[model samples]
Target chain A: MSDFTTWDILRNLLLAARWTVLLSLVSFIGGGIVGALLLFARTAKGKAGPAFVKTYVELFQGTPLLMQLFLAFFGLGLFGIDVPAWLAASVALILWSAAFLTEIWRGCVESIARGQWEASASLGMGYVQQMRHVVLPQALRIAVPPTVGFSVQVVKGTALTSIIGFVELSKAGTVVTNATFEPFKVYGLVALIYFCLCWPLSKSSQILERKLNVAHRNH
Target chain B: MNYTFDFGWLIEYWPVLLKGIGITVELTLVGGVLGVALGIACAWARALGPGWLRPVVAAYVELIRNTPFLIQLFFIFFGLPALGLRMSELQAANLAMVVNLGAYGCEIIRAGIQATPKGQFEAGASLGMSRLQTFWYVVLIPALQRIWPALSSQIVIVMLGSAAVSQIAAEDLTFAANFIQSRTFRAFESYFVATLIYLALAIALRQLLRGLGWTLFPKRTAR
Candidate 1:
């Protein structure tokens, strides 16, 4: 029964909002790095590399982010290691985002016509050189829109980390609501804050998607 | 440290796991079917409804699309109770799932609807068909047939997303994993099993949707 004003609640939520932004950045960056390697492995065209990467992507994408967070938090304890909330949340999101980003970028890489690889090979470029020079440049353009769109997913995904007591925006809303006993106002603000964080990226993703579609059509 | 992984716990708790899997499948199937129906309606309204209604539907789509499903579940489960609307966790979870899956499905299906050629509608109109008849006979079914793959994939995504409902204690597979982990202190093993269960369910659901599509759209089978 605390008489906390709406402004006080929002002020606290704004502070917690910083963690949400930080977590999204960490997960997206970490996932981007891991996902790049995974995309490479998936397209490596070897005996077992493709299969291994396929399994990795399927494992993370097929399950829930909440379960992934729980496993990262509590599962590590079973291996005689205790992870902090920050590390656990980051690790789980990185893995989750990696699975998705790998799939997305793989689509980009694969969309490059077969002739480009063949032509690169004919010029005596090794696999690494061909990928580094020829394929990646072309694929990066096709990859931009989807990657931006997927970032929205990554941002929303960080909210799941709050389940493990990570104290992001959603968790902070819970804390504020508990103190104020104003679930409607608290959650409405929570939704609005999330919308503010996500709407710009969402709009840019649509714009990028349309622009890319036009470019692809013209080409 | 000599720690033995007791998969014996898994063996003993097999029935609980099975029951959990059953509940997960039930929720996903029920939610997926209903969500698709809701999606089609919303998509139709957004695409063909009166001008004023279209923007409102668009706003609904955007609002739900950008927010996390977990928070939506909380708002329904926790927030509603404050307004004297008491729902069990399962009802709240299902309602949230339906709302969430519908918004996504609406977007995908609306794209499909727009892709339908205008000529098809003209042909239906030339036959003296009413607007509803033209939409149903000429537009809706054919549009869905073309977009069946995307629509089915979205259903699988919905099924996978159902795992988020566990936070409200829906006793889905993830919830069961949480219970098993606490009881046996084998969090890894518990979640590994749960993940496998989810994978199996996803594959099965995809197959089921494919079968349903084949049955519904026999003429499109050649494609």
Candidate 2:
């Protein structure tokens, strides 16, 4: 076994962090699509649709994401589906994101007043039209800060994907640490990389919230 | 490929699941209580401590907030031993939880502090309460009361996230699931059951925290 220098460890981690970023992007984008559909269902014209979506959100939100990833990794295999770490991690993460994003977006939508909805209805606009022209425009404002805040969470969350053998930044940190016997240097570097990724997002999210004047204490 | 799901482990491994649940609860309790207390101090230092200390606290908050808890745990559990600071698995897990939760709890509590009107602090001073007394009676309590709901959610999030603590062999709920599955060849069933138990815990915890929040600010909630 050759000695792995700090530079070598950092180099390998930088390569793996790419996958972390990629997984975060995939999960966020996939989640956005799935979440939007769920949000619509949540607000659809009936008690049943909204009720079902509520349970769906609660189920996802209430359980540990680790368990979800485990199930996705093993459950599919039990059902005769060949599960790769990448595929299982992606699917689990996307579902997790979808549940959370739906809840976040729903909260944003709910923040829009009843008067706006009624006014839109009185103007001969249907539900979809009302959302398009009035409701969403306003809800998107309140949604931006929290959504950005949640994205920070999503980035941090990608680290958990390493558990199922996805070889992301965290896993890379472990591999390098084992090779170099320099856990502090390797893991510190890993933490630094994650910080670099997340700090800008955290800072900008606060700035955006201030700009949008949506930094309400309650949220 | 004929796959059969058997739950014989439920009866045979009841004690294992119970033990895991017990350990998880203990970790959450310790982590939640100590973490919130640490957060209160950090938030205070950030808001009104000596000018020299503000930047230090800010850095701590930012660093922890930005990194994943898993890395923090790994660094403490695996990396610290390299530096000749050794701890048991349980110690490492609890320390990581406290540190991670403290960072987040600090942010949440600091937001509440920032929202407190200046007049309130002045009121405390005018009443001849010492600075420390004023902060305790006026600033910290009310801020905590106001932010309790958000803090409650954070506690649950930390608890849920504790599942990852098992990765380091802390013998929490997730560890038990992995243990039982390995013994029974029923990974799916084990994990599925674990998820349900976690779901129940999360829901129950949220309710408990909400109740705790109301009790923390009886005056505010009485209105």
Candidate 3:
């Protein structure tokens, strides 16, 4: 067995950090698109739409993402269609992210005062037109801080994909640790990589939260 | 194409699955209660403690908040043994759950505490209450009442996140489902059932917490 220096381990971890960043972006963007649809369905006035959205949210939010990953990866094989880890992890994280993003965005949309919706309706604006012209603009402002905040959650969540052998940051750490017999160095580097990835997002979320609060207060 | 899905394997393993569910609930409840206590303490320490200790509390919260729970679990279960502090997988997993929940709880509770109106503290002080007495009877209690909803939801999140402890082979619901799947080759069925069970537990826990909140914070009911 060969002992690796700090530079060697840091270099490998930084490389694995790329996959973590890629997975976070893929899941966040994919989840945002799907979540927007779900948010629309949730807010739209219809019999079946609300129930379907509720079930969708509960199904994803109620269960653990790790199990969802397992179901997507291993469970699909039972149906005789093998799924690559990339596809399975992407699909699962997207669904998981959508559930959360939909709820966050819905809260933002709903926080718009009742008077705004009524005024748009009084002007003969249709539902879609009203939402497009009046409601969403205000809601988007309220949504900014939470959306940025939840992104930190999305980044941390990509760690679960490692359990399914997708070879993102955490899995890469495991491989390096086993080979080098340096769990402390390997995992410490892993934590530092994660910290480097998450700290900015965390700090920015706080800053955005304060700025939004100030804006709300000023208005 | 024709396909068949069999769920008969569930019948043979129902007892085992039920036992796993029981263990899952036990772990979540134990972890949730202890975590809330720890969270409350951490929140209080950060909010009202000496100036020198503020950074210590902040660092603890941030370190746990930023890292994924899986690595934290590995450190406790796998890494601690190297330091001559051997713990069984279950003990280490349970300890890690409490610590993780405590960090999150601290942040949420601290927010609630900060949001408390200054008038309440003044009122308590005017009634000839000591600082300790005033904090307990006036600030901390009411602060908890206000943040109970957020606190309970965080506990539920901790409970759901507890599923990750299965990575260390904790014999929780997920671990049991994995075992049954390997033995019976009914991966989808086993996991589907596990998912449904988890959903039910989450809903049940939410309702339970809501009821507990109602009982604990009767004064808020009038509002």
Candidate 4:
């Protein structure tokens, strides 16, 4: 039997952390695009659009992500569509991220006052033009902090993908623990690596929130 | 390709599902109270308590918030035993859920605390309230009333998150699904039913928390 050193373990874990990074990136970016579509659908001038978006958000948000992964993995298999663990994990997280990102973007968009919309409409602007020229630009400012904060959540969300056999940092920790018989050291390093990934995002989110709230500070 | 669906397993496993729901409720209820309590304590230590303890509380909140609950669960369930601390799967899951929700709950509650007006403190002091009494009755309750909605949502998030605890063989709803799936080879059906139960639980829990919020903060909430 070959013995693994701490270096061997950390190196392997970092190797797996690469997947964690990749998965988070794919889900975040994919979710952003999908969330944008949901945002449009949500804000479009219709009764059905916003209601559908609400149900979409609630359906995704109300369920556990682990179950979502399982459903995507096993649910698809029932349709004779074989999916690797990573693919299923990505699809699930993307939907999960989209639901949250859509809601965040909706909140940001809704924070725009009615006057802006009315003014844009009074100028003969269509819905898209109003959103483009007036509402979204302002909403983007309020959106940045929470969006960045949610990225930390996205990164952390990747950790659960490990449950379905996607070998991210958490799964790597488990595998390394079995190999080295040192769970404390292995998982402590796991948590530390995550902290390194997330602390700066959280701190900057706080800083940005403070800066953004400067407008309200005077009141 | 053709496939037929069968829910016959569900009928046979009704008792298992109910047992799983019971365990899940137990986990959420325990985790919610303890977790929010931890949040209040941490929020206090950070906001208005001793200066020396601020950094420690900050680190605790950050550490728990950034890491995933699954890893935290693994760290406690698998990692802690190596350090001479051992616990059952239920105990470990409870601890992880508490710490995770506590970090989130701390941030939510602290926002409420920070938003309280400066004059409220003066009013309490003028009314002959000690610092302790003032903080408990004046600062704490009002802050809670303000943040109850956000806090209720956080509690529900943690409640949904309890579904992950079944990973450690904690015999929760998800664990029951896994068991039934293994026995019946109906993976999709099992998880679907289990996820539905979880969805129902989340919705019901949210409604219950909202009702609790209305009852608890009746004076603050206007009709």
Highest-scoring model, TM-score = 4
| Poorly placed runs, candidate 4 (over 4 Å) | B220-223
Q: Give lDDT tens digits, candidate 2, residues A1-219.
A: 898777888899999999999999999999999999999999889899999999988989899999999999998798687899999999999999999999999999998899999999999999899999999998999888888888888999899989999999999999888778888889899999999999999998898888887455555
Candidate 1 is graded, for docking, as medium
Clashes of each: 0, 0, 0, 0
Can you give the TM-score per candidate against the true fold? 0.95, 0.97, 0.96, 0.97
Off by over 4 Å in 3: none
- Candidates arranged by TM-score, highest first: 4, 2, 3, 1
Of the pair 1 and 3, which is ahead by lDDT?
1
Pairs clashing within candidate 1: none
lDDT of 4: 0.91
- Chain B of candidate 2 vs. true chain B, TM: 0.96
| Residue-level lDDT tens digits of model 1 in B119-199 | 988999999999999988889998899888998988888788888888889988888888888898787788888887888
Query: Just chain B of model 4: what TM-score?
Result: 0.97
**TM-score-best of 1 and 4:** 4
State the weakest 10-residue window (summed lDDT) of model 4 chain B.
B214-223
Candidate 2 chain A lDDT trough over 10 residues, lowest sum: A210-219
True contacts kept of 1: 0.59
Higher-lDDT candidate among 2 and 4? 2
iRMSD of all candidate structures: 1.7, 1.5, 1.9, 1.1
Please tell me how candidate 4 rates in CAPRI terms.
medium
Residue B2 in candidate 4, Cα distance off native in Å: 2.1
DockQ (Cα-based) for each candidate: 0.64, 0.77, 0.60, 0.78
